[model samples]
Target: MHRLITVALAVALGLGAGSQAAVPFYDTYQLQCRANFGAAFNLPAGSFFTSSTPAINNAGQVAVNLVNVNVPGNPPGVWFGQGGTGQVKFVAADSNATIGSISLNHLGRAVFPQNFTSPNGVYFYDAPSDTSGLLTTQPIGASSFGTPIVNDLGQVGYRVSFLGSNAWVSFAGAPPVAFHAVEAALDAASPYSFLFTPSFNNSRQIAGKVRLGAAGQTGENRPDQIRIINPDGTFTIIAHDRDSDPNSLFLSFDNSVALTDNGWVAFNANLFPAGRGVFFSNGVETRTIAVNTAGIVSTIESFGPAASASGLVAFRAFENNTALRAIWIGDGTTLRRVVREHDIVPTDLGPARIDQHDASPVFGGSITINRYGDVAFNAALTPPDNNQIEWGSGIFVALARTPGDVDCDGDVDFDDIDAFVAALSGPAAYAAQYPDCRWLNADCDGDGDVDFDDIDPFVALIGS
Candidate 1:
């Protein structure tokens, strides 16, 4: 069987040059919830997701924040759901307290902050145990806490603000530690302060943006810099606005930063004098993933870019000329458009147009991408009926097509052999033969291509 498969793969490669049809890159788009419509708890009338970014873990579990607009104070709540599953469940809600943004871990645990209960601070919800509890409160002398994120080890990192100073604190089953504080000196000449909300990775490293002056300094005097605080209390500066190297220079950085376990820092910033772009660096080398230019992106949104452990970065931006907002994924060399404003997507409720009204920075819905390249986001939808714009907001997920599932049956098996060959023949031929499946399913190595390098992995998956 292996010999025959190898021969078939060779022949398919020989035929690759014959076709050039476009193939779909993703396998599914799942709608977890829509305004007035959800598989779990029914949202209050006129409820919409607040300006909190959605979070997704490697396990494909997603958590998002919700707000009831009809309510006088716009009370908040948190909702949880899984990819490919239509069900969404209410994790927690408080009519009297406003819930902060949330972060999910591979263990299906979520962390957020709220003041509704006593000892108001960051809280955790364990999906497996179906229980919730307070993870930690404000550190001693800290007046408030915000932007809490949980890593796979269940450790929580957040920003703590005092009377006039701010610090980034991390908690691991003990009293939180302020790893970095405002007005701290990055070096002899750079008295960097004012840390932004940070991204935490399993390596115990926290990455964030900092201004290069005292806390209250504004404008160009306090230029932005990206730094990663290591586990041993040491830190590395990845990029600086004042760097003499033209490649590392930037006018300013967005407040958000994403850190991967491998130490890549992903962010978006304004280019000096003109243009904006998304970038990722390893503290030694910086790479531009996408930039604003004619016929390409016109404006890259300032909401921090999301980075996966595998080094892929995802961000929201506006397409050039058209000014259409879109969610994009890149691997530092190639970019793929995930979804765009006004694009009609298939939903369980039927086809709906992706309305950008609620996806703005003011409305929340920042993009989140996992290691598997799955992107989670919130958007307002216009149903096929074209009515009911008020009940249009929804949380949606785009599931990346799994490698080797060439037949698109949600699995890899013996039946996929012929379809796999067709996919290798070229996207055009593959689409002609299997119009419903993605040619990318043949990318068993997940290198963003269908080629001979995938044959061995494909065989192993079926053989196992």
Candidate 2:
């Protein structure tokens, strides 16, 4: 199945034997993983990972939460590791301390919060610094809240507030500054209610859910909305419908929001009795993004939604009639299913894998998208019955599909030939080889078969 190319052609192209674009983001391809069940690189012992989602960065690094089962108490916390490696690494572990939520930035720095004890538990552990410490030592009432976030500039965002009291968005700086707080975050009412912590952009803009009372409307009450707090301290209402609409119906937003560096906001909202769906706000207009209009019935959209800088939104949606669940990525214009249950993955790792369970929805299993159009998601794997261990649950990273990056490692290299060869062997072989990768239509030359005729064009494309 090897493509017979002249040595001169291979050398002139500057690519080795296996170099080629594996596939496109919307089509057949194998998924490259960044983290999976294994021993911790730091502990060098076996570990167990929960069903929670992991954070990913542009460098293909994954921030995973691992519980070291080898330890007596089975202490669990955050760790950083890359795919294809034999080890997941430990980031931090404090005795009796619990890591609430963790997010990794583009720089691979991980920001996480431990128990409600403020000025003591919250910290940013930098792999390069080989250190960890209190980002904010100020006393924050233990509200059992707060999701730690790290941005591109290494800025960390954390929410500090007691239940029903004032809320503050604290950033770890030379001196921690609350990005927004009770009396200061909003301009509407005397008492402000903050729901979820605001999501931040590279420009330091923040998008959050807050409740504001609506006046001069019949039956239209105060609605929870997504608002953006700009660098100048002024806020813009990205999504809120506590007012009269042209259809005389009222709309409201959910507590979750994800914003990108380009000021696009992807938020969850209730469109009255029509059911909840994701809405996109580009500053001027906010409209409900449709999951599908082609289905027999309306596609049932699940609540958890994640948006990327390039305007791509990743979420779970299912067919109303068939109940066929799928993970989809949409760019407001084109929508495609990224993965679905039972689909085979094409990989060079000798054997393919399959998606065993639905990608975890929303809060627990979120689709983490990086700038390269790569997405990191969590899924349960179908175990191969042939003496291989149970494929268990794990986090997987999918590249946007580079044509010759057949190995799905995000580039065209000498390693893709084996994977491409497997893909040419048909779906059954592909599934057997890489259960996590989906079969591709590798008919490169449009000859109706993925055979010899496809070689020249594929090689030329890779060279170009």
Candidate 3:
């Protein structure tokens, strides 16, 4: 089975030309299922669900706002749980509030926004303390602050109301740093650009949306933006609504942007003459990794990108006007679909293999990818019923595998040999292209580095 998949990758990736860009073969690992999600709740019979916006840290620790509802209860309260095994542990609870977002850092701690509650505001959860604390309790009022994100250094950043965002850093002995409003830095450039949907990285960088005009503008004039706030207080407007920069030709930068530890920001943008697509920038050069079915730029969702420090990017895309949807991954140079609608996937039902997937239409859907090449996402499973189709929503995780599977088609063929040679000659060049990735695949001998020792292993891989 592995050999066949490898061959498919080699042929599909156009490896005969020895392109360095590669597609990856992923080993899918089912971490939890609908039963697992329901198991987290101690509800009556069948009331179960977590917030659609789930988070996964680098250590594979997934944090979910498990919604535990009871029969005839006032409202559902969001519970927090972690890890793959065992029932979920207890966390904070709040009725009359629907959490817009929850983000987990490397330490498993999280900061999120809660709207529709008394003193509506954002809160923080610390695993070490096993307690939830307040970042700000003042009413969020509107869904202005997209989602609050946290870093390992106890630095949390989020938008406040509709004005802008602020970063709150915690110090042990001193009073928490006064909210360092990044918007204050942004207003210097674009006057009254209401910032929303701020994301954070360990490097103290934040990327988010900045509304160009006043509130209540909903049309071609509606607000849309993409901005990156550096730690040094300098800000860059990647794209915005009605932007007229002839060089890039972007009609509008969508509302969501994902940030990684090294400051790589990925966002979906609508481009003039190019359509919509996912773009990644390191505050330097920007590249549109994926385009539409006609090779035109496009994106599946508004906030549709999840990135990792290992240079792996996960996103969803589809044809311009079709139900054919696909989830894709980009390994710096090449972008390839991991799964698609109507694609057959093996199931444990013994004789039944489900091939169709149901698409989710919710904004800010929980899609994630880690540095280790593991992808966590939520999609609906479509199985044929009696002349009908039944949909079952599920959360999944896939691990990237197959070394030398450049162009990640899963095959290690002659194309890999040439690509590997180029990578070996100057790994720095390749690393520069994939700053978040450390493609150590050339270490065929199982040694740490891709050095001379890997030559024999490379030969064996080909001979096999």
Highest-scoring model, lDDT: 1
Q: RMSD in angstroms, all models?
A: 7.3, 9.1, 9.0
Clashing pairs in 1: 51-364
Minimum summed lDDT over a 10-residue window in model 2 is located at: 212-221
Root-mean-square deviation of candidate 2: 9.1
Query: Scored by CA lDDT, what does every candidate get?
Result: 0.71, 0.56, 0.55
- Top-TM-score candidate index: 1
Cα lDDT over the full model 2: 0.56
Preferred candidate (lDDT higher): 1 or 3 = 1
In order of TM-score, best first, we have 1, 2, 3
In candidate 2 the C-alpha lDDT for residue 154 amounts to 73
List ranges where model 1 is wrong by over 4 Å: 3-24, 37-46, 69-75, 84-94, 176-178, 184-190, 218-220, 243-248, 356-363, 385-388, 402-440, 443-464
lDDT of 1 at 53: 77
Tens digit of per-residue lDDT, candidate 3, span 97-152: 55656777878687766666554666676666777755665322233444667778
lDDT of 2 at 327: 68
Clashes of each: 1, 27, 17
